[model samples]
Each structure stands twice: as C-alpha cells, then as structure tokens.
Target: MTETAATNEQISATLVLPYLNHAVRMYEQKYASRADIDAAMRFGCGYPKGPLTVLDELGLDTVHDQLAARYAETGDNLHKPADLLTALVGEGRTGKSDGRGFYTYANGEVIADDETPSADDQPQLRHDIKKVGVVGTGTMASGIVQVFAQAGYDVVFVGRGEDKIAGVIGGITKGLDKLIEKGRSDEATKEAVLGRLTGATTREALADVDIVVEAIAEDLDLKLELFRDFDRIIKQGAILATTTSSLPITQLADATSRPESVIGMHFFNPATVMKLVEVVTAPATGADVNETTLALCAKVGKVAVSCADRSGFIVNALLFPYLNDACLLAESGVELSVIDDAIKAEAGFPMGPFQLLDVVGNDVSLAIQKELFAEFKEPGFAPAASLEKVVADGHLGRKTKKGFHDYS
Candidate 1:
C-alpha cells in the first residue's frame, strides 16, 4: 500500500528517523537478530545500543514523536520512517509492552530473565584470600595494597627498607582517607582498610600470604632476584604475580622453581582507578594460575583480558605507537600547543601528545619508548630525540613540573 501524503509529511520531522525506522522495520520483519541490530547501531552510529533498545528504555512514543518532529524540520530522506515503525506507531504497539515492537514486555514491564546471565553479568569468583603480600613501595605497590585491604584481606606491604615500607603505608592511608572524603567510601570502611595493611621491611614477611604480587622497580634483574627470593619464602601453591608492564612473563617465571605459579597481573597507572588489568600468561604458567589471577582481578573490580607474555601486551602495544607518532610530530618543531590542538580536535583525543606525556611523566615515556624500540627496532617506535633531550634537561613531565608545557 502506498503511504498517505500525511505520513510522508510526518517523515520530514526527524533527523535519524529514517535510519531508526528502517532498523525497527527490519527487526519487526525478522530480517535480523536483535544482537545484530544492536551491533549495527553501536558500530555504525556509535550509539551505546540499538534503536530498539533505546526505544524500550526511552519509551517508544517518546522517540517516535521526537523523530517525527525532526523529520518535520529537516525534510531529508533520513527523516523518513520504514513501514514497520509506521505500522507499530500507528497501532500504538510501542516496545517493552503489548508483546510487540522489537521486544516483548509482560504486564507493562520490561521482561528480564533472572536465570540467564546478561551482558553485564559479573559472576564473583570465590577467592580464599585471607592474606595478601605485595613487594614494592611505589605508587603501584600502594595501589595494590589498597585493593587487598579494601577487600578485607590482610595485606603485607614489603619494601627494601623500613623508610620505604613506612612511606607505602602512609600513601595507602592517605589514599583511603581521600576515598572517604570523596564519599566513595565511609570512615568505617577506611578504618577497616587501614587495619588490614601490615608494612614489612623484608621478603620473609611474604611467607604467610596466600598471594604475592611483585610491584618493585621495573628492573628485570631486580625483579628476577625478588622472584627467586619469593619462591623460597612464599607458601607453595600460592599464586605469584607481577605488575611489570613491558617485561616478559616467561623470563620472570624462570627465576622461580615453580614457574607454573608465576603470571603477570599488569595493572594500569593509577591502578586504583583504571579498570583494565592485563593478565599475562607465560608458556610455563599453569591453568590454575591463570584462573586464579583472573579471579583476583574480578575480586578487585577490574576487567581482565588474558594475553600472551609479549612486551607491552594489548593496550600498550597499540597505545605507545600512537604516542610515538605524536612525539614525532613534536620533534618536527611544530609548536607544542599546535600539535596538541590539531590531534585533540582532528583525532578526538582527550589530551594532546605532549600534554599526555607530561601527565604520564617524560621519564617513564622515554623508558618505555627505549624498551619498545629495542624490541621492534621500527622507525615509528624510535625514541624522539626531542623527548630524550627534554628528559635529560630534567623536564620530566608533571612530576618535575616542566615537561612539554611549564606547569609553573
């Protein structure tokens, strides 16, 4: 049947009306699955979910009316609706109700299956972790200590000296206090978290912990020595994990007799805030070790992705190349602000390369770039001579307050 002039006129009011209407029609006609429709919407338009899902959440008539208004204004083909959406709107068969329109709703409510796990299903892993041990007194170590302590696990924070251990504990306490002040946590929670931490001045303090995470200075030899010592001290069957970002997990595993127990649990910077935890598995790492590490990440409210024991792993492997490219741009003597502005505007980056370098610390970026260049020997990964010069000048980003831009 041909559409009425009124229907055609109504189509002129919406911007994305035609696209959404087409999707609805296709879905109703059983042309594709809801998953495919959702995928198309998310990937095609960058909407968080499909039109149908959005309709269900926003109420169908609301979206339909909004589209109709946009169509009235634009008079573009994009505003026209597919036959399916027209029919559903005409019949008042909006989604999440009346058993119609992309999805069925029971008793005027969106039906949710309790038996099956949904996309957001986060199944908790039962970790029998009573005590946790962490080696290192730097930012990463303090963050690790916070994670365990907050989870009600007794944490043994180890450092080479009493002063370092004291500093780590102090940092952890300050972090917890910040959380409480921000209302993200309560005073009682802060107390409990602080009560769980025990700073140790030696490796022997890790003996009783169920899991030991090495977060020491990123020196391969130093890490290997620490792992060997941990092998002799930590209880057998206990999980041995590392927070090395670039080092190979297999080489670290070789430092211990029980290589099967060793794995890399690389936490991103400002570990307490970043959600990603790359669970690096070595050739010698046992299946149980992998599972336990994944479980531990979940316990700490992190999303873990398992990867092979390669330098830089997934995110960094992709991330650093882009960063290196940015450095190259800066090396061309493009004003720092110009380079930053162009990339931020054109590429939609959150921060310009130089700005991000400052935030990440120039020294850290130089070290990582050196490691990447050594491994790949690619021109793209080459450390920008400009960056090296800046670091040598002691302009080590935000920490030094004088990197790409002067903080002072």
Candidate 2:
C-alpha cells in the first residue's frame, strides 16, 4: 500500500513501473520508433527522458533482474520482462555504461542519432498540400495557423465576424512580436508570415485549401456539423483533419463521403513548443491519407506518431492514469508538494501531478479520465473524488485563472 513516507523504490514501482512495462511491450511490437516512444513520453508526460532511454541509462540487465525477481516473488504477469529487453540483457549489452541496450552508447553517453530513423525510412507521401484552412479563432486555432504560416504554407482561418477575426490576427501578431523581442524573429519575417495568412468568416473561403483542420468546440455534435459542412464545402481530394484530443475519428468521418480522407492531428498545448503530434487513424482512413498526414507533420517540423483512434492516443493513454492516481494519493492525505516533489525529484518528471493538473485544467483532466474509464472500464481510471470537486467548483484551469491552485 502507498504511504506518506514511501521510498524512491516504492514510488518507482508504483508510479513508473507500469509505464515502463507498457513502453517496452509497445516497442517490442513495433508500434512506433524507439525515438518516437521516448519522445512521446517526454513531450506527452513532461518526463525528463523516455522509458527506453531510462532503461538504457539504468542498465537493461539490472531492469531485467529486477523484473525477474519481482515476477518470481509475486508471480504477477505485469512484472514479466519484455522479450526484447531480456534478449538484450542476455547479449550483455546492459546499457550506456557498457555501450548498448535499447540504444548505442559510447563513453557513457547515448549516440542519439544511432536510434534516429533515417530519411530513406520515411512514410509514403500523399497530397502536396500548399494551403491550409483553420476553423475557429481560439488559442488552438491561432497556434495552428501560426505553425502552418511559419512553415510557409498559405493559411486561411475562419472566424465569426470582423472583430473576432481581427482578434485572432492580433493574437498571432502579439506572439510574433514576442518572438521578435527575443531575437528569434524579425519584422521582415513577421510581415512575410502575416502576409501568408488570409482571414475569412465562411466555409466558401476554405474550399480551395488542400487541408482543412477543424479546431472549434469539443462538442461532438458541433464537430459532426462542421465535418458535414466541410464534406460538402472542402474541395474533392482534400485531406480533412480534426484537432480533437479524445473523440473518435470514425465518428467524424461518418459525416463525410470520403471516410478514407479523414484523420486526426492532435497538437499539444501551445503547439509551437511541444514537439509531438498524435497522427490518429480510423479503420476507414486510407493508407495514403495516413502517409500524407505524417508527411504534413514532417513538413511543419512536428514529430508525429501514428496510432489507432483510441482514447488518449499513445501519450495520453499512458500519462493520464498516472496523473489520476496521483490525485487519489493527494486526497488520501498525502501533501500535494510531497507527491509533486517525489515525482519530480525522485521520479524525474518535469512537473508534479498537481501542477500539471492545474495547467491541464482539472476539468479537462477529469473529462479525459472519464473518457478513459468509459473506453477501458478500468477501475484505476475512475476520476479522483477531489478532482471532481475541483472541476465542479468551476475552476477549469488557467482558462478560468484557478483550479488545484489559484492563478496569480
């Protein structure tokens, strides 16, 4: 049982072990790149390093023996070591200290490029999209618009009226100004980027764009309505994508005649900073559609991992459950900072669960947990009682300027 004075080993076994096991099994199955898996954990969970890298650093042989001992003691299937990990250990390629494990290492440092997939290994190309249409005037829409325009794609964004449209543009400009102040950009580059953006208020304006991404409200009906409208409005042969974090892609695709053309491109918060984007595929999504979505992500400089259109995709699937458990610990009388500090200092996460919950919006976290519980029906996924109270209190997050912690 978890206790107030839990040691690092206890914390690691409880908080980090399940994720490590999942990562190893997934990597063995070739679900994604070793690089992508590590990158996903880092970008998705705010971890200092990915699980594979952590294994390599800790020494695969040590991890193998640890699992072996635990499995022998408890006979729990979850404690079983992954075949790949065990096989590597059998080869004596323990980890970085000895030069190899999941990654190649020399002089105790990982040769990162050794694990990077090469250009020749790239995914198939689909459409050569030159223009992108962004639906909505909110933070996500603006950030996505900036990302496309900054990547030299002509961007057309939709808003309700002149003022709302202006506000979106204004937000983008303010961000550009920040870049200029930091010497990361200049007036000339900002002007060129701004020149590539065309703001409109109607669906007709989006017709010619090769890729149209809907980034509006999270409501399913609203998304369905927008998808139906785009099905008729967006040009034939264009790729239709959604920025949805949790909804099913097939549900949206059902509204369109070209189910094969629909996909999900979930960009993380402040899309410009986060390096990972989940490239989700419904069963009906065409092979070329998947290829093009990955291609588009590469073009815009985002690391994309393709996954089934399941709840939480890859990163969120592994991350949110851990965050939920942390909440349960907090509600059971563990000091908030203790859990946060143990996670950050002992477990190597960048933020405590509480801090992350505050940033992620306790409401958003609860919604995702609810979706996870419904999808998997796992008891561990049931939303924390305290988290439910926080959301019910109406402190959504930084959006509402309060949540687990009061915003200053």
Candidate 3:
C-alpha cells in the first residue's frame, strides 16, 4: 500500500477499532441483541455498517491484532481486544474471508440467521395514551409533534410563548407542504395531521395528556424542574418521558413522584426522518412503561432499541469516544483533512469524524464526552483537550462556521 493509504488505515483503526471492540463487549453483556446493536448504529447513527459487521469484514484476527497493538501502546483497557474476538480468532473463524466471525457468511455475504427476538413481538400497548403532550417548540419538539399528530394521536404541544408555538406549527405546515409538492402526501392528509395538533403556552394544558414528552434543552436543572412540574400536574399513572441524550434518567425519575412512569424516550434529531428511538429504562421504570414506550415507537414507525439508562446510552456511548480519539489523532500531527479522507475511504463511514463533529457541534460533543467521563470515570473516556480548546475558543462547529475545519 502507498504511504497515504497506510496513514488512512492507521487513522481509521485509531478511531473505529475501540468502537468495534466495545460492540463485542456489549453483545457479550446482552445489553442488546446482535441485530438490535447493528440496527442501532446503522439506522440510528447512519453507520454504513454496524460494528460487528465491520469486525467481520475487517477480519477478527486483524481487529484483534490492531486492538492488541493499540492496547500495548496506550495502556488503555478499552483498547484490549474483547474476549469474544480472541475466542473467534482462536477458533480460526477470522471473518467473511473465512466464512465466519461474529456472523456466518456464504459466498462472501452475511447470511440471515438472527436468533434475537423480533421487533414485531411486542407487549400490549397502554390503552390510555390517546392524547400526547410534547414540551418545547424547537426543531426536535416540532418534529415529534408532527410525528404524533401524523400517527393519529391528539398532540398538544407547550411552548413558552405564542410566537414559538406558532413558529413550530408553521414549520410543520411548511414541511407537510413540501411533502405535498413531492407528491408523497395529499391535502386531506396534511389537514388531518394539522387538525390533530394543538398548541398551548401553559403547563396546565398537559394535565390531561396521557403521556408528556419533554424535548427541551439538555440542561439537568431544567429537566429536573420540568419533571417535578410534570409529576404534580399530570394525571395518575401517566408517563413522563424526557428526550435528554446525556443526563441520567434515574435522576430525572427521582425528581418525580411516579418514578415508574419516568423514562427516557431519546428521539434522534428530525424525529420524522430518523428511524431510531432509544427507549431507555431507569432502574425504577416499570415494565409496563417500557412496553408502552416500545409499542408507541412502533406505532410511529420507528425501530425502538431498549437500553439501561446509562449516560450515553447506546449510540452516543459508542460514538463520541471514537470521535474524541480522532481528535487525539489530529493533535498528534495527522492532517485533519487526511484523517477525514482515510476514514471515509477505508471505513466507508457516512462522514469523517470532523465532519460529523461540525454538524453535531463541538460544544455538544464536548458536553456529552464530559458526561461519559463523569459516569464511567474512565481515563480514556476523557474529553479530548483539542476538542475543549476549540469549544473554549467559541469555534463550536457549523453553527459558528468554525471547528476542526472552517465552514466559512
């Protein structure tokens, strides 16, 4: 291979190897199924291939060696090769090349033999959730409102002001109109969806709502405050869910009288478009509440993956660390553009880490990293200093037109 190709491979390994390793560990722990784990990254994060599949393609032996080398170099436990990977290698089931690894293969293609439970086999949904309340009028909130309204639920959204409420409604209308122009929807459908939506400026409007989804800012104080209010104002046995990506769901639940009803319904941005909803369950989350949330996600045509209420949950837990490792690689003298190109070309990721960081915002990335570091207390999980410097300098990302790379 050429010099450039070698660097590309090195950078790609530096970033993705740990994630692939963690995916193996996650599978071993039974946090999620092989299928759900793969789907979470594929559909949820838009990864070209899930970590296990990537491990298969990269060859278990190859990954093991790379991870072992990385572990020796960094002395990071996360870099240590997963026991499952080592076992597979020892058994001589390297990867697709040898027709085995994390999955069975035929003719260099993965065969379908998933033994995991199907998404179709879900518990009965709660019958009381005819009316849904969504708090916040930002992009995520508006998309969620449209999702519930379109799904034939009576959606009541709360905003701080009439202008924000109207703005969310207008945005949803414009989106529906765009769909009409694309011939994917009709006037009647648009009107019916819009007719199902109601907006209010007070928390009192949500008192009668069967389920309230909080999509406000990602501040713990704000979410705890909202949860307290939700506990007081919402009816008995109603679900109080937050869309927080980084905060501890258990703490959020502790703030509410009905901890069993408090759960994390973490929807991806552009809720109408993303197919994944992580139905995170706190220790106090009721089994029925978990079932209801899963059933509701299926109702809205999303693939819901259930996980324990941990800091980053699934996607962010695995993703930001890789991105942070990429930052470290850049700080060690690799050109940002070169690292980006190598990742795209070698790993077939949707975008390079830098590109994704810019779109996601470096400040947000740093915040999530901090949360992860705080939760796991892993030295390797610490936020990259380079990432912190960029955020501190106010080069947030696309929002600020500057980050690892300049948008301007």
Each candidate's lDDT (Cα)? 0.70, 0.84, 0.89
Residue 260 C-alpha lDDT in model 3: 95
lDDT of 2 by residue, 1-408 (tens): 346577656655555665676678778877677887788888766678998889888888888888778678757555678788888888998888898878887787767565667778698666879999999888888899999999999999998898878998899899999999999999999999999999998988999999998899899999999999999999999999998999888999999999999999999878877878889889999999899999889889888887888788888777887788777766766667677777887777888788888888888899999998899776667888988998999987777888777786
Write model 3 residue lDDT over 89-153, tens digit each, in one string. Answer: 99999999999887889998777666645557665696468999999999999999999999999
lDDT of 1 by residue, 1-408 (tens): 122221222322211234355456556655444544554334322345565766665566766777667567756333445566667778877767445555666786656544323866443443366788998888888888887787778999888788987888788778878877888888888888888888888789889888899998888999888889988999888888999988878988998999998988988767777766777889999887787787777787776766677656654543455566556545544456766665555434466668888988888888888887787565546787888888999999999889989998
| Segments in model 1 whose C-alpha atoms lie over 4 Å from true places | 1-127
Q: What is the lDDT of residue 253 in candidate 2?
A: 96
Candidate 1 overall Cα lDDT vs. reference?
Answer: 0.70
Candidate 2 RMSD computed on C-alpha atoms after optimal superposition onto the true structure:
3.1
| Full candidate order by lDDT, most accurate first | 3, 2, 1
Clashes of each: 8, 0, 0
TM-score against native, each model: 0.68, 0.88, 0.94
